[model samples]
Target chain A: MINNEVTKLLNMTYPVIQAPMAGGVTTSELVAAVADNGGLGMMGAGYMTSSQIREQIREIQQLTEGPFGINLFVPNEFHVSEQEVELASNRLQPIREQLDLQQKEQVDIPNFDKVSESFQQQIEVVIEEKIPFCSFTFGIPSKEIIEELKQHHIILIGTATTVKEAVENEKAGMDMVVVQGCEAGGHRGNFLSGDQESLIGLMALIPQVVDNVSIPVIAAGGIMDGRGLMAALCLGAQCVQMGTAFLNCEESGAHASHKEAILHAAEDETVLTRSFSGKWARGLKNDYINEMHEDESLFPAFPVQNKLSQDIRKAAAAQNKTAFMSLWSGQSPRLAKKQCVESLMEHIISETRKIGRKV
Target chain B: MINNEVTKLLNMTYPVIQAPMAGGVTTSELVAAVADNGGLGMMGAGYMTSSQIREQIREIQQLTEGPFGINLFVPNEFHVSEQEVELASNRLQPIREQLDLQQKEQVDIPNFDKVSESFQQQIEVVIEEKIPFCSFTFGIPSKEIIEELKQHHIILIGTATTVKEAVENEKAGMDMVVVQGCEAGGHRGNFLSGDQESLIGLMALIPQVVDNVSIPVIAAGGIMDGRGLMAALCLGAQCVQMGTAFLNCEESGAHASHKEAILHAAEDETVLTRSFSGKWARGLKNDYINEMHEDESLFPAFPVQNKLSQDIRKAAAAQNKTAFMSLWSGQSPRLAKKQCVESLMEHIISETRKIGRKV
Candidate 1:
């Protein structure tokens, strides 16, 4: 029963994939550990430059002979005025002051053209490196890009938040689709559905997406242990993509304070906020989130707001001040444990087998 | 494998409970059909009078030999000014005109004392009629009422939306707790957690509640079929309480227009709104909800706002206009089917067994 189409396609022992979380969370060590443990490990290359991506692919290759995947953020056209950027940056003056960072008059703003070019370079690196598996988030790639990747014999996965988006991905020639539920951490993968409409839970999302699309469906959200894997399978998902569970692993590059915050958080403590990035993301409640709650809508879109908060997030992390850093976590923080990837993978596999025996 | 503590306590063949969806959805025929099919059928008695409650209990007893349950709404103290009620009522003038209902100068509003008195009498009917099982929503009952029910050998269940609330239910001596997820249709049962915080999905909620409380957790939300039933069990829930799935059953007393809206809906079509009532509820988006979206926070609390919209809802239903009526549904509308309760129960059971053999 464990040997399904997803396992065979991915050439992994289990239908488990470590979700590609952006930023510095997915280190080479973490990806290699997950791959060596017989699960698909995905490098979070959303914010990495082309050279950084090439270097990491080489590093992971040295650590493990097993296959690993890489995820890229599909750049979306964002409109932001210089005045709006300045206003948003000034609004964060107090936070920057609190973190003892200098107030700069000039900030390196990201234009859509530059962002689009960066995404192309990242995709080129993936093709050049011949990564076995590749996934795209935020939005789907163009026909040319998808065809180029397929021509290299690399498996393609698309992230979606609704059935309509899943159908779109299938029509766009994606090999598989990852349906992200509302319980997922980090940035939402909703490109078609509006923010309010896209917040579908896995219980409802999995079955509906499974019925609509013929391709394999991967469930991603608050899944933590073996129970979640079996539950997702029963809901008609062929595989499970976990984020917060792997974010707390020993090899993960997440800040110490971020991991500690998730370890102490309850289910209800995490909330959605667009303050950190123009896009909505779920994280633990902290002083920065609370202080910026009221002005979340006034900030500029995506890469702009994300760039504005870079210095503050960096300074806070360096000083070990979790209250100012973005502590992304899913709703099931209570089930998270600080451990090695090998032990976490073993526990999940064993638990899946145990539940199989009982049910 | 399905005969767990909850099944034994509720004295049912299947660990399925027809959720007590208030406002005339749970008809005696629906309750009896579920009970005859070996699943626990619950009466939605939150809005029923004492006499109505007593009459339905007797009618259900005649139709089915198996045990059934009833649910009550625990009254909370609401503060609203007479001016606030008038303004809220006037805000619905457009909807009332659309429904062809005459707008009244004064709307009869509910007070805390009267709502509390009604709850006490509902409890009296349950005890006097010797109902086998009882559940409470909105919040847990007082200590005296809990002890009184226990003394009569009535199995008590409490509704919770978070781990803290589940722990509170266990401390209050509830035999079992229903952990309602954000994907649930109709009104939210959150009391302790705020609106945003209580929106945890079942993928996160079930496991956390299972770890925190000793009582068996009954998973609610977007669960629709045997896949959901088995998934809940794997998540450590002893049983499942389904609302939207049964709401579409032929035996249910929901308006035909309401059922039809759900049948044509998609997973992302349902949204959470407090426009219909003072409290937040998940339902299909309609003209009425969209009109009141901006002024949602200005309305009075439950029972009061629920009372203010009564005339419009009734007229809309009478005229077959679903736009102004409340069409409650969970996130899994695509899986909904227009069938009898017996077929739903049978399908869920057979599917559970089928999944058990495969997994």
Candidate 2:
């Protein structure tokens, strides 16, 4: 029964899922590699438009016939007040002056319209493409949308931080829940109320969710290798989704500097900060994170704060200045290997088997 | 330089040292086992008398001719007023009644005399016995005592939570520093105060300490297996120290229930709570710790609270009630192997070598 679920998700002999990290880092090649290796490879479409996501999904199909997934960021309308944004923007004026750029007119609410438009269009594409699996992050998609996706026989996985969220996802008729711990990279998926209480890690989160809900649980966060994968399974997770580990793979589209930073990162080098997108996310601690932490007024709410700092981030990336870029990675980034996706998956599978035998 | 320093102190091919856990868990057999495996074995003398410590050390010596160390809990004279203890005791009255105990009486302060007597006597014994290493926790020992111990040419290791503590240890002429992170199992070693700002994990702590001071840095806390060992080494730690990992081994003296609890523990199951020892320590979360957290007034200072609850803890352990026992373990206890010391170390060495190659 376990093998059936595992094989169905990854189209592999073993059930392991490589997390899709969008924004050009998780590439079609990486997705294809995981799919080819008998695990599910997901294409992250957080920053991409519907057309871009379509192209990436089609690109993965071109290389492999195995099952793959597409991950989407559910549009969140929560925004910081106008006063908060101006206060945050004024604090960034010094950096603006330092960058020798003209200060743009003050805008109260940050633009989230782009995100909504992209999400809506991406859903249409998923329907048209008949994507085998789809996952939502940040928050649960609307019931109407979930029903629509279910009608097409799509495997719907919802990201959850707490057991309550997992139960809610199961009640909403989702196929599975990804129990994201505090140790996970990227935006924390605190969709339901009382998300802070849900900051329970994968170790505690997986088993409790498994015991509480009747659905299969997928473990995420801080899982980097076979040992982690095996441990998750032993703790009741049917499969594991790894994001930061694949971020450094040769098939990833992450910047060379970003990959290098991850390879050299110590377990302590990562910190959970909201400096990047005005939402709590884990990344390599650098000057930008440090500055925002020191002066909270410098960071606006998501999309707004995220959009305002987009130019500086791009400039920093172009200049290879990693201290200012969001080098998103998990605590186990140091264990990540610089190898092709197929080899990495093979290594993970073999290692997990060894761990299983030891257990 | 690092290798030589490590070899000289622990008298091992490698400098890895395992932290001593108290309350009868870290046994003489466990110490001897680690020493026999070419790492420093330390007997925790936190709650034992001078004679008991001497006997434990002698027991370890009889088991292995290899070098071993003794760990001491430096006296932390936290002056919680009588009223406070009374208030805390009053809060515990309900539970005390349930256990059929009389109203809590004034438990005398555990004499600091025992600590000094034990230290002075242990120093003489170590010198006479020519023990290779001695480590201190809770706080640094007196400079005069440290200097006296140095005269015996005994290797000294001071535990530190922050870089400042590491620097202070070096300034005090200690041989090495065990960089204990916030994730450490037993009581925290936050000597150089300020709300414990350094919250640094092993990965970040080791490199920063290595960069800041010119001494061998031994990393501790949350390190369980070979990947952790390799990751610490890659971060510039001379070696690694693990307590909870060793506690699950066959040689460990921890209660069978404690061992079972550790084996069954998940990643996020451990939490930092002051409920057990008046001082902050990490252990498997249970009803006692949870209740204490919910009712802050129900806990007294270290030694006092620890002394008062000793009977209850013993009864709980005797009854095989996991919810009432201390259950000390780290976040990665799930990764620990329930095997003999020799086989566990062999697995660690092999796994470490495999991961080391990738780095």
Candidate 3:
């Protein structure tokens, strides 16, 4: 069996990682379960506050005394004009009122002005808790912070949507990099260019990155089973990081209907739409995307648009209506299976071992 | 060395086939060159009349006694209301005048009503000429036509953009099916479902098709060179049909500027746009797609819009301007090379063999 290089770095038996899915998807239970199964489990700490991150870390430690990682989003400081945000908010008001979603109290969208303060606090917690693994997405982290993390013996990983980002990550001394393909779900981790321009699929991404950089490479996007694992290895990946595969797992934090939507998604049904969030994310087509897609100029840049749609998405999920929910999934969600994390891990490992020898 | 199944079936040395590209790209020289190199070459006859097909067949026969295939576009009959056609015409008036392309005499757009007559004439030419191999795309051909070709000892292949379409091809008695992933360039092979819903990528397509159908599967889309050839083999495809890789070949009929565009296209530059043609096609982003994309409602269905934009496309190509041309490409244009067809074929075969042994 090929004991991939990333497994040694992540302190895992199998070269498989449960992709950290932000926006209320990955939970402490899910992370603990994945780690307990002898794979790298990660907390999606990008959307969490310092307190929430601390609580989740302790809860994960309580459930499983195994190594795990936390994923954070690098700061992308950009502002949507007040006129644009106001226009976007006004346009979404009809959808919000029609769904009667305003009644529910909402969590504040993270303010970009205070983003650095919160991010610093979160990084401090990772150091204080002696977190062993940490990954960042969206953009390259500052060199000083990376060195600080390295001093604490933290194995740093970076998410890249393009080869340039991967090279930058390597220059920043990341131990590894997750190459997120265009087929990946959620917001793209593009920094050097427009996320749309960085749509390099994993099949083309892995080998090129391997050829250019010395660091271990992790493949992500549309990887759902052992076949995907074997293919990624064939493409020269050190490991495979899968998010869509675990979306339906029993320990996953996905709402029942969100999980159902993922289970029922067809291979080609999910599309990159900015209607749900200001940033491009792959999700199953819903009325929200269709209705607001006519005039994309009406939507503000991400975070603002992501924030405005949050309440409607929450309401859609609460009522089990997919009409407005951001059913984030990879391109091949049809391959998803509902099982426990352990069972999913077992099948992937066995299948890879079975097929890995033949190739 | 792995002797791929399609190679044995087609009496070729390598499991590579030149994808038949219509619209003035694939030439008799390219086809003969590929066949001469021990790879299967295909004549794209979907855009040619019976006499043109006969002349090209004779030209190919003279150049290489080795077998080559002819690809036809299955007649998809649908009436476009005159109003829709007029709206499409009106929308292009501004683009047409801006490019000063009105000097060229326009060929009458094929009347959908007379489609069967022309298709019948083409098939009759195929039969009378005793063509050895034939393939169909766009939709399923009639049983009588397939039976007729089979009686002539012609090996038949059908194009499918999804597994369901692949199964349908098998049921219709095609010898094999080309499983086209969304990553493929040119016009999509979608018929059963809307092309948008048929955007399944190659990584997810090849394995599922191989599992579901007993017939040999020829994988297409995003396959650039020998590494792609090896990957398709690992995915259980019997062979690969690559179009983008050959777009820049010296023997190809693509304009020099088109070749340059394909060579320079970024990973995410190509997108599915119906602006050029009524049907969704992947190509480099140009002004035609960008300006016309906003009011796609003003466009008519395939062949019509495909025909309407011909003058503008021709003008743009003549001027060496990318703003109005359809630089058809896939997601991996960065891997394309500008070489003679013979050199490209040699490189691909050698690379596949080298990588195939290692994998």
Candidate 4:
């Protein structure tokens, strides 16, 4: 019903995007379904191996000729000391007991120094496939890498938590920027620091980002339906990238328990905690988080905490226990329903039109 | 441009309610001007004594025949121990020295147990005058009093920070509720433990409140214009209450420094700190707050801290030093302008129409 630069640039029928949620939730089928529905479906390559990402992209390419996107987590460099690991392990030991995990501590925690290779390999896959669109979160890529992606004629969209970060993305010559607010689910794409103080909410962050930046802006966070879409556009966002709205899509690879947890979530149930991944992420707060989220010193930074909690998360998911799984959800998770992406897309469009008629 | 139940209930042409900002900001002139322009203007009676509020109400009655609102801060009970006071005073000594205040600790702080009298007297005035609209923040009023207000045909509205708070307001028999989000400037209306974690943003808060309570919903916080009205309406809000949007209106009673600070605010500059009132509030983060906001233990409980910092706020306002003033502002403070209320209201109506044409 509405046309904008985002719809034109991404070559999609609508300005809505199925936000590329990382951590194995956004599956190839989900991407294909959203793309088939005329929204830009994004293939999340953050946790995928180079081969896995390539195969997924190939599957989507075959499923629909409609343009889609690939999302990558820009890797950060950090040193994890043995003491921090020990402290994290010790602190997590009590939580494992509470969750009744078979293992005390997760094994095979990837070393950050060695993480660059996998990240670089994934980037290579993106470049080789000549993906039409790509977005990066957690941080920004280096100038050389950005230039290489641009050389392939890929449009790069950067994620920002604050205006300062959005300006940095523009300075890096990103085609567009996603202004992710605090109400967003999963890990916060905060590159400046690990503190929660930098977390500004969407209503407050959008207008500020719009006024300061010249590039097209994509609004993300608590948006769940067409009302959210309308609100985002009113706030000056050219497009909206919604994760939670598509979180329970039938084609989504999210765990069954994750979907159920989202459906059962109340308005204020989600809490922004680093207990799951050592990075601030909003998820439906459960017994597991309440017990372990008291101290930050006990968590060993980023990938370390993310990797260490995998066993517990996996065990919880296997048993279908909502308490222990990292049910990444926005504050508006209550709005989520278990539907196919196409059906959900139809609902959003219709609802937005209904509201638009009266507006 | 838009019509809803809120406009009909409040007898306004627009679905906009000028927020009743406390701390000497919402002047009688501003209230009358906004009401005269066909919007439901609110007279902030949060800081005034019963006599002062009565005088202000009478003054506004003479200035404009249009309907307006009166806001009262529901009182809280707390006892600040000598040790807590001493600890707070000790921590504040350094900051006081920097500000060049002759005295160290402010004396004659009002007691919360005694705060009941003043709060009770204000309620008596509202009842006596048969005020058309009344709203409460910080906590819910007693049931008996709510019933009395309803008997008098007072359209009672309650302020809420979360869904639980909104439900509580409805349970107490409020006619409507104001869903104030974290993006709201001034003291958060949180009656729960005074922590910033309870602060939820507008995008995440509005829909949740709308569904949980049967009462008509008024969305507040970070809403700056008619675009905000359209968004709130789409989210199921019957009306929108905006504070920072009109803080710099020509008829506002805000200090020059206060207005200036809001006009120049950045996206992430505001912080929800207890340093100002011992109640968590969002305001432009200044050098004084930066120096003293490290630990909550360093501040005494509510009104004591509010009383302790009175001299600094007064002195800063007089000398035009924004660094030491509270400078209460919502997240979208940058959207504020030095203009008259009537003209700003007209601009908002026109802009909403322009955006509506595209939608």
**Which candidate has the top score in DockQ?**
1
Q: If the candidates were sorted by their DockQ against the true structure, best first, what order would they fall in? A: 1, 4, 3, 2
- DockQ, per model, reads 0.86, 0.08, 0.34, 0.60
TM-score for candidate 2, please give it. 0.64
Q: Any residue pairs clashing in model 3, and if so which?
A: none
Clashes, model 4: 0
Encode model 2's per-residue lDDT on A108-226: one tens digit a residue.
35366766776888999999999978998878888889989989989898888877788898998888888886667777888774433445545445656776788788888877777
Residue A96, model 2: Cα distance from true site in angstroms: 3.3
Candidate 1 per-residue lDDT, tens place, B124-187, comes to 9999999989999999999999999999999999999999999999999999999999889999
DockQ of 4: 0.60
State TM-scores per candidate: 0.99, 0.64, 0.90, 0.95
* Candidate 2, B223-281: lDDT as tens digits: 76665665455445777898887888999888888888888765556777777677777
Model 3 DockQ vs. reference? 0.34
Model 1, position B7, has a per-residue lDDT of 93
**lDDT of all the models against the reference?**
0.93, 0.74, 0.82, 0.83
Which lDDT tens digits does candidate 3 get at residues B45-154? 88899999999999888999876898999988866776776677778888888787674454477677687788888998999998877889898889999898889988
TM-score of chain B of 1: 0.99
Model 1, residue pairs in steric clash: none
After superposition, the stretches of candidate 3 with alpha carbons farther than 4 Å from their true spots are: A80-109, A167-173, A207-214, A287-300, A315-318, A322-324, B80-106, B287-297, B315-324, B353-358
DockQ of 2: 0.08
